[model samples]
Target: MHIKTRLTILNFLEFFSWGAWLLSAGAYMSTTLGFTGVQIGSVYATLGIASIFMPPVIGIIADRWIPAEKLFGISHLLLAGLFVVLTSMTSFNSFYMVTFLVALVYMPTLALSNSISYYNLEKEGLDSVVTFPPIRVWGTVGFIIAAWLVDVLGLKVSHEQFYLAAAASVLLGGYSFSLPLIPIVKNTSRTLFQRFGLDAFVLFKNKNLAIFLVFSVLLGAALQITNIWGVPFLNDFSISYKDSFVVKHAVFLMSLSQVSEVLFILAIPFFLKRFGIKIVVLISMFAWVFRFGFFGVGSPEGMGLLFLITSMIIYGMAFDFYVISGSLYVDKMSDAKVRSSAQGLFMMMVNGFGAVLGAYISGFVVDYYTANNGIKDWASIWFICAVYALIIGVLFALVFRYKHTGEENLVIKK
Candidate 1:
């Protein structure tokens, strides 16, 4: 097979492993395991908690010693076993422990997967500039497919979702071994801190990077709000919009965001090159406003449905322009030696600290509005979320300063 095809398959299965349970896990925990609201939030926060340090630590190892592909494979291999264990856990504490371990083993794979792809792509003499976006889009497709399969197959409330994800994890783990081997040539001249990737944290010493990272964490919380709450938000619509097919098939409806993701992912290079980081990021922040506002105001039926659909469309820009572009920005800002670690640190901020903050706060907002029979005043909840995004956008525009000289000039694209 072509190297692109191999990497594409790798990307697909990698996301499939997460998609099989990511969006649906809440329903299973609530309905099946009888977890409380706090328990459920904590369980999902495991991803954020693990993401905080795992990526940088493993990234340091990959950069200094072990090949990224090998580490990627081993993480997934262990993840497969852990997912299997997750299917058998009956209590909240046990499930939390196992899930945290699963997240620890799994979160770092995100950056590792990207590094492995970049390493292999460069070796093949293919331009990641042109090759990677298309290949990575399949990962979104795999995520959507998993959401559809679990929902359509009646596995959302069962342990089978974890099993399905584990099977994919097993396949991905084994397949990762076949990826191109990345070298592990450590720089012996580096100090101990540099050797362990503590050096990547130095970017925080720069004023602009410091400002960017702080805002990245704040915006990242917005991303987490949607991912953690979107499924339930839509499902709640089935109460009033009972006859609406969109509400009935909320998972598939939300998958439209992923479909939109593919398009925006392709367009990222174009927009970032044309508008530069500030404008592109502003686009994302503003898009988040609409993303949450539409959710807050729109109903599953009536003309309000238009807002929901539009929100899904905006999600592509919201996610692709912000998270994806932000990663590229981190790549541009950091030196080559700290490349992997920088990516890990970026992941740590957005997926880790940001995600934890979003999960807890959103949980509070949800509980605040929740009433008898579990019905929630979603509009008020979403309104507050939208306000938060708006605040971030305004703050980013006013406080986060940068001059655009074109992305081609950046270290990442070059």
Candidate 2:
């Protein structure tokens, strides 16, 4: 197989492992395990908790001593076992412990995947900036496929989704061994912190980077809210009206967001170049307003479903433009030695600290607004999120400034 093809397969399995459960896990928690919103939110925060330091720590190891491929394999193997253990635990506290352990293993793989991809691409003499987005899009496709499969197979509310994910994890773990070996060349001259992408913090000395990091954290906090709440939000619509069509297939409907993700992912190069990060990200933020507003105001009936559908459509832009474009921006600014760590730090901010904050706060909001029957006051929740995004968007526009030279225009054409 071509190296690109092999990497594409790797990318697919990489995301498939997460997609099998991440989105639908809420349904399983709420409907099957009878977990409250706060409880489920706490469970989801495990990803954030693990991410706070693990990525950078593992990244330091990968940058210096361990080969990226080997570490990637071991993480997956550990996570597969954890997922199996998670499936066996029936109680909330036990499940939380198991899931947190799984996240400790699983979260680091995200950074490792990027590191391995960059390392292998360099070896193959490929342009990572040009090549990676297309490769990464397949990961979203895999995620979409997993959502569809879970919805269609009626696995969203069952333990089988974790089993399916675990199977994929095992496959991915074993397959990672077959990829080209990445060298372990440590930077002997550097201090301990420098090896961990901590050196990239120097960028914070620049006003633009400092502002970028702050907004990125704010936006990242906003980012996970939909994924954490979207499925359950839609599922609640069904509970209010048991015979409702939307109730029977809430997961499939929610899967539309992932479907839209593939299209937006392909559009990133075009959008990022023409509009630049400011406008492109602004569009994404505004899209989030619509995303939340629609959910808040619309229902499963009448024109409400239209609002729901539109919200899902805009999610493609909301997710892709912010994350993919922000990553590329970091790439443009950082040095090669610390690039992987910088990326991990970015994730730590958005996925780690941001996610933890979002999960905890969202749980409080849901618990405050929801009825005993588990029917949520979704409008209030989404409205609050929309306001939060709007504030961030305005702050980013007013505070974060950069000139979009034609450099990235040339980049996208590749």
Candidate 3:
């Protein structure tokens, strides 16, 4: 098979494992397992907790000892076993422990998968910028398809979603061994701190970079709110709109956000070139405002449903703009020597610290709005989220300062 085809399948199954359960897991925990908001939030926070340090640690192992492909395969095989273990746990402490372990093994694979792709693409003499986006987009397609399958097969509310994810992880893990081997680069000059990418922390002295990373954490918090609550929020409408398609196929409807994501990614180059990074990121912030506000006002019928659909569509801008543009800005601002580490730091801020903040705080907000009888006030919850996003946008516009040069370019370097 062609390398491109092989990489496409690799990317597909990579995200397929995540898509099988991420959005619906909250609903399952809430309605089936009888977990409280705090418990569920803590469970989802495991991703952020593991993402904070594991990727860099894993990167060190791949850098010094093992080939990237070998490590990638091992991570997934481990993840498959963990997912299987997840199916058998029902207690809060046991479930949280297993989920955190799964996150530890699984999160690093995200970086590993990208590393594997870049290695193979370069080996085949393909321009990664040109060939990889099309291949990578299939990951989004895989996510959408997985979500739809869960919904259609009636697995969204059952442990069976974990089974589906485990099956995909097993296949991906086995297939990874067949990919081109990534040779480990032995660099003897680097210090222990440098190996862990801790050297990038020196960039904190730069006022602009410091401010931008601070906001990255704040915006990162917004990233997972919908993922954790979106399905359950829609499922709540089952009481009012029993026959509505939105209620019955909530996961399918939520998959539209990923579809929007694929489309918006194509537009990022143009937006970055024309508006510059600051304005582009600000646009993303406001998009989040709309993303939540629309959900606050939307229902499963009439104009409310339109608001819901609009929220899903706006998710593309809210997500892709900040993440892509912020990464580009970090690349431009940092020195070339620490550039890769700088990017790692950026991910740590947004996906790690930011995600943890969002999970706990959002959980508190959700529980605060719930009555003693278990009735949740979703509108209040969503409006609070919208307000938080708006505050971040306005504060970012006023406090963060950057002069945009028209010469900025978006380059994806491995």
Candidate 4:
């Protein structure tokens, strides 16, 4: 097979593994297993907790001892077994523990897959910047397809999602071993701190970078709210709008967010050049307000349906602008030597600390809004999320300082 074809398949299965269970898991636990909001949130929080330290630790191992491809394969194989185990878990404690273990083994492969792709692309003498996006987009396609399959097969609330994910994990894990080898590079000069990317912590001395990172954590808290609740929120409508297409196809409707994500990514360079990163990021912050507000008011009927769709569309801007643009900003401002570690730090703040905060707090809000009948007040839940985003945006505008020159440009370097 051609190198691009091979790498595309790798990227496809990589996200397919995640999409199989991620968005739908909350609904599964809520509707099928009768778990509480906090319980569901705790389950999802495992991903954030594992993300906090596992990736960097795995990266160190991949760097100094094992090849990236081998490590990636090993991780996925373990994930496959864990997914099988996850299907049998019913109690909250058992489920949370297994899910956390699954996350610890699975989260690192995200970075490892990227490393494998970049290594192979460079080996083939391809410019990754130009070539990789097209390949990576297939990951999104895989995610969408997996979600659709789960929805159409009526497996969204079934343990079958884990089974499907396990099948994909096994396929990807085995295929990984056949990919081009990624030689481990042993750098003797690097100290333990540098090896673990702790050197990037020095960037905190800059007030602006420090503030940006802190807010990154705050905004990151918003990132998983939809993933953990969007399906459940939509699924709730089955009580009132049982025959409605949105309820019947909630995961499929939510998949539009990923579609919007692809389209919005194309617009980032233009927005970055015109408004610069600060304004662009500010636009993202407010977009989150609208994103959640729309969800707060939307329903399965008439104008409410439009609101729901609009929320999904806005998701693209809300996500890409903050994450992609913020990464670019970090890359541009940091010294080249610490640039990689700086990027790691940004992810740590957002996906690690931010995710953990969002998961638990949002779960609490969900539980708070639930009445004695166990019915959730989704509008209140979403309004609270919108208000949180609005406060973050306003505060960010007032406190975080960055002056954008008219000469701003978007240049993604390898």
lDDT of each: 0.84, 0.81, 0.83, 0.83
Worst lDDT 10-window in candidate 4: 405-414
TM-score of 2: 0.94
Going through the candidates in the order shown, the clash numbers are 0, 0, 0, 0
> Residues 1-414, candidate 1, lDDT per residue (tens digit)?
988899899999999899899888887887689776667778878888988899999989888888888899988999999999999998988999999999899989888877777777878887665677788889988998998998898787789899999999999989888887788756774687765667888888777778888988898889888777787777777676777877667777777888899899899878877888889999999999999999988777777889989999999999888887887777767776777788889899988898888878877778889887777899999899999999999999998878887645455321
Off by over 4 Å in 3: 1-4, 118-132, 195-197, 202-207, 327-343, 409-414
Best by lDDT: 1
Worst 10-residue lDDT window, candidate 1? 405-414
Position 160, candidate 2: lDDT: 87
RMSD of 1: 2.1
Per-residue lDDT for 18 in model 4?
94
Residues 185-267 of candidate 4 have per-residue lDDT tens digits of: 54554577766545557677778888998999999999989999999999999889999999999999998987787777667
TM-score of model number 3: 0.91
Model 4 steric clash total: 0
lDDT of 4 at 71: 87
